[model samples]
Target: MAEKKWPETWQEVNPGCIVFRPGSSRDYHTGTWRAERPIWDNSKCIKCGICYLFCPEGCISEDEEGYFAADLNYCKGCGICAHECWPGAIKMVGEE
Candidate 1:
């Protein structure tokens, strides 16, 4: 009897359909599909983490400087981060 060999990594698996593995999506960068991008203004940011709370993708993170920054590699540019910013720190700019 022959045994099936499973893929060791997510990238090694077939890409035909969606695979529901917890935290597996982190291995793939979905930001390539974004039409617009978010730009953060540090001067206006209050470090309240409002953008981080509202981001559906959870791509926003804090930097070494104690400021919240978005991971554009995984951000879809949905603008939710910008919309939720009370201090108008995040701005959604068109991708050109």
Candidate 2:
């Protein structure tokens, strides 16, 4: 697949608060601004989907093995996933 291109600055975005099209936010990769990232401990995970429900960016996804994983491409690392994990399976770590 071809790599997605993103706007380099806010000036490239639509003026005002209106989005010309719905779901257009998917076109922009906003994860680059995250200062921290969430790390998942599969051994402790309960698959409750709490993290998935709480994630603002909707980046957590189920893997082929049925284990939940974070898509860093869209995850802004807001820490909500880690906080919502009842099993304490998610931890926040500084972005490398």
Candidate 3:
């Protein structure tokens, strides 16, 4: 019997079907379905780390200066981070 090879990247996956492989979700870009994108305003940011904590995808990260931002590659644009931001530093903008 031939061994089944697992896809190393998301592009290799068949359309409309997903193969159950360990850690396969990482290979897929879930952010492609996002209708909006999050924009961070450094001026209004308080460095409270609220956005990082509120992110459902855990895509938010802190910078060297203590500012938080999301990685758009994995961010779903759910706006949870922007909505939870106390200082309104994060804004959800429609994708063009």
Candidate 4:
């Protein structure tokens, strides 16, 4: 019998999948990704589409008035959206 090896990084997991560290309170990025949560800076947002344009998961969306938001269930917490926000409306925060 062979023991299954635990993946050491995010790249080893299937895309859009993540697991928390064994004893930590919150999840951490695995394989190639360090799990990051999105923090919205509402005052800084100018309703620009930069973050929306960069989100690979298509999880962020806007209401009729164009307030941007993330649909949490589909969000993989990838920081590209946050990293690309021109006005700094979005920030990738460590899990609480």
Q: Which ten residues in a row have the lowest lDDT in candidate 3?
A: 1-10
Task: Please report, in order, the local distance difference test score of every candidate based on alpha carbons.
Answer: 0.82, 0.82, 0.84, 0.69
lDDT per residue as tens, model 4, 1-96: 122256535556644554434543223323124366777888898998877888876667987988788766567787888888878888887754
| Highest lDDT model number | 3
Candidate 4 at residue 62, lDDT? 85
Worst 10-residue lDDT window, candidate 1: 1-10
lDDT (Cα, tens digit) per residue for candidate 2, span 1-96: 223346436756556745566676787788897989999999998888888888888888887776788888888888999888889999999987
Clashes of each: 0, 0, 0, 9
Q: Each model's RMSD to truth, in Å?
A: 6.2, 5.5, 6.3, 10.5
Give the best candidate by TM-score: 3
Give the range of the ten consecutive residues with the poorest summed lDDT in model 4: 23-32
Residue 63 accuracy (lDDT) in model 3: 93
Q: What's the C-alpha lDDT at position 31 in model 1?
A: 88
> Which rank order by TM-score, best down to worst?
3, 1, 2, 4
- Candidate no. 1 TM-score: 0.74
Per-residue lDDT for 49 in model 3?
91
**TM-score of predicted structure 2:** 0.73
Q: TM-scores for all candidates?
A: 0.74, 0.73, 0.75, 0.59
The alpha-carbon lDDT assigned to residue 86 of candidate 3 equals: 81
